[model samples]
Target: MSDLRATFERDGFLVIPDFASSEACEELRDAALRLVEETDLESLGSTFDAGGQRHGHDPWFLGSGGEVRAFLEPERDGDRLRVNKLGHALHDRVPLFDRFSRDPRLAALVAELGLAAPLLLQSMVIFKHPRVGGAVPAHQDATYLSTDPSTVLGLWFALEDATVDNGCLELLPGGHRLGLRSRYRRDGDRTWTDTLSDEPWPSDGWRAIEARTGTLVAFHGLLPHRSRANRSSRPRCAYTLHVIDGEAEYEDDNWLQRPPTMPLRGFV
Candidate 1:
């Protein structure tokens, strides 16, 4: 997708309309809700927050109810949840990941940016709860991913309507062109933190993307972006698919690195 590349370079992000069908969103949403219902909040792993909220239970690890929800709502820094609970199944299934992983359009984009082959490592869903605008402080994804600049791509697929009224994503256009910045700790209840830019540049072409269910937004990891609190009646939910050059090493620590209990192909 040269279009994807162009938008990424110019706006630091590209929103692909109707990239997923409404039926797909419904299916995933139902699955997530069911998992939440069948799960026990206390039995799940404990991750303590700064305010002592103890919001550590990942929806993915609670028996057959699964761990996808918690994986999506990852605990803040210093939490013991190592591997992403949803990585194994998503790595095995999810055609969306497969197509992007194998597509020449995406592959070439990675190469053009000087990234390795394979083009992706971790893929999972991210769901932001209503009235729950936790900290996703302004920072580059590179600070957390630790990959070569411009070599990584972050794809976010909205399964529900995402809008400014409900914490839709806000971005600074062309921010990726700037090299990496130092990391910083998050202030207040924000979950992530990073070194702030001395002369922070607001969006010369700032855009507040409000898309219907099934819209896909792809951007460089270094783009400075954040979403407001979800004041709307609905949860601002989206799926994040992290793709790096296949040739690139897995530099960050996330659930993709977890030791599988069983191999799908039985290689392990």
Candidate 2:
């Protein structure tokens, strides 16, 4: 654990192999598919393109932080609806997701990473569908979920094998030391990104992290990371959770905000 902590402190990211069993991964995948099947596609018209120029301003997108909402991919096959992701409040709304999110192993991981009072802020299941899975632009987690002192930690779990050909995560080692580059915040009904630093992310040191099923990759809030478009026939599915230190003051202007009825929770 000490070694793991040291490595994480140095590189700003750590990849743990087989953190969860194959059965657990399969269960989560099945649950996500069930949620998609139960959703009424005809009622949903919002197409979410993560890499779009006008990202994060949509009312539907901005309002999803406290509810379980499904976002669709830009492309569709005739009447067939392709979902890009299911997000924000799955940990609180869905039984399976809630159990997984509050698992003791995860709580231990958070403690080992040095967060004394960790608050789970957001959760998502990203379905990188075959042929249409869009590319995610390089950005930091703190941009979307900012805290005063910046104590956000991202936990990405691979539900299926993440390969280089299937849009696996690519990260710049030790890039968190470069500091926060920008912030995505909400102003009344509108949302915009504020640039805090002009420093360019290095191109050469980026490493593609190809993970096997059930692998958990934890990264710092300021770590620079992105994924390419999935051109393969296989789908790269992954579950993610973002946690912030309760000790830090959460920025009110941050894009993802929960209503007063729903307070943030920690893994018990």
Candidate 3:
């Protein structure tokens, strides 16, 4: 754990291989598939971007969203409900997901890192569906999660092997020091204008952080990263959870908004 902590602090990310049990990974994978079958993607509203492309917000945009999700097929990028990513927060809505979010191992890791009382801020399931999967534009997590000092962490658990061919996460080392380059979120009915920073992603030092099934990866909140389209035969599934320092001041206009009556859950 000390080595992992050092690597994360130095590089802005760390991948811990074979951290979870195969049984646990399979259970979460099964739960995700069930969610896909049970959800109605169209119920979530869609808005057009400046380029006239229909962009669908995460399940948080629609109060009833997050049960399941899909990505728009870039080839036929229209109003399609093609599945890709699962959510901004599922623990608040799903029993199985809620359990997954509170994994003791993750809690221990946060404590070891010396983070202030870790709070569950967001949870998501991202899919790199084969062939028609789309590329995620390079971005920073803090773009959506706006904390005053911006102390946040991201945990990505690989439910399946994520290979370079299947759109594994690629990151730029120490990118968090760039201090958040953009802010993309909903402003109104047709808001797609995103703010940018002078600091741009380095054109080099990018490497894929592939993981086998049951592995976990940790990254800094402001790290700049993205993934490619999965052209491989099988799809890759990953479970992602985001945490914030409980003592930090979280901005009110974050893209993922919590209800006024809701409280952040303690992890460690």
Which candidate gets the maximum lDDT versus the true structure? Answer: 2
Error (Å) of candidate 1 at residue 164 is 0.7
List model 1 lDDT by residue over 127-207, tens digit each: 566554343546666654554433557767787899888877777778887866754222222324345456665647666
TM-scores vs. true structure, each candidate? 0.68, 0.96, 0.85
TM-score of 1: 0.68
RMSD of each: 7.5, 1.3, 3.6
Span of 10 residues, lowest total lDDT, candidate 1: 58-67
State the lDDT of candidate 3 residue by residue for 43-139, as single tens digits.
5343222123355343434332233333334343244455666665676667777887787888888877667778888887776667756677787
Report how far off residue 240 is in candidate 1 (Å).
0.9
How does candidate 2 fare on TM-score? 0.96
Q: Residue-wise lDDT of candidate 2 within 70-171, one digit each (tens)?
A: 989888755678888998889988989999999999999889998989999999999999888888889999988999899999999999999999999999
Q: Candidate 3 — worst ten consecutive residues by lDDT sum?
A: 44-53
Name the best candidate (by TM-score): 2
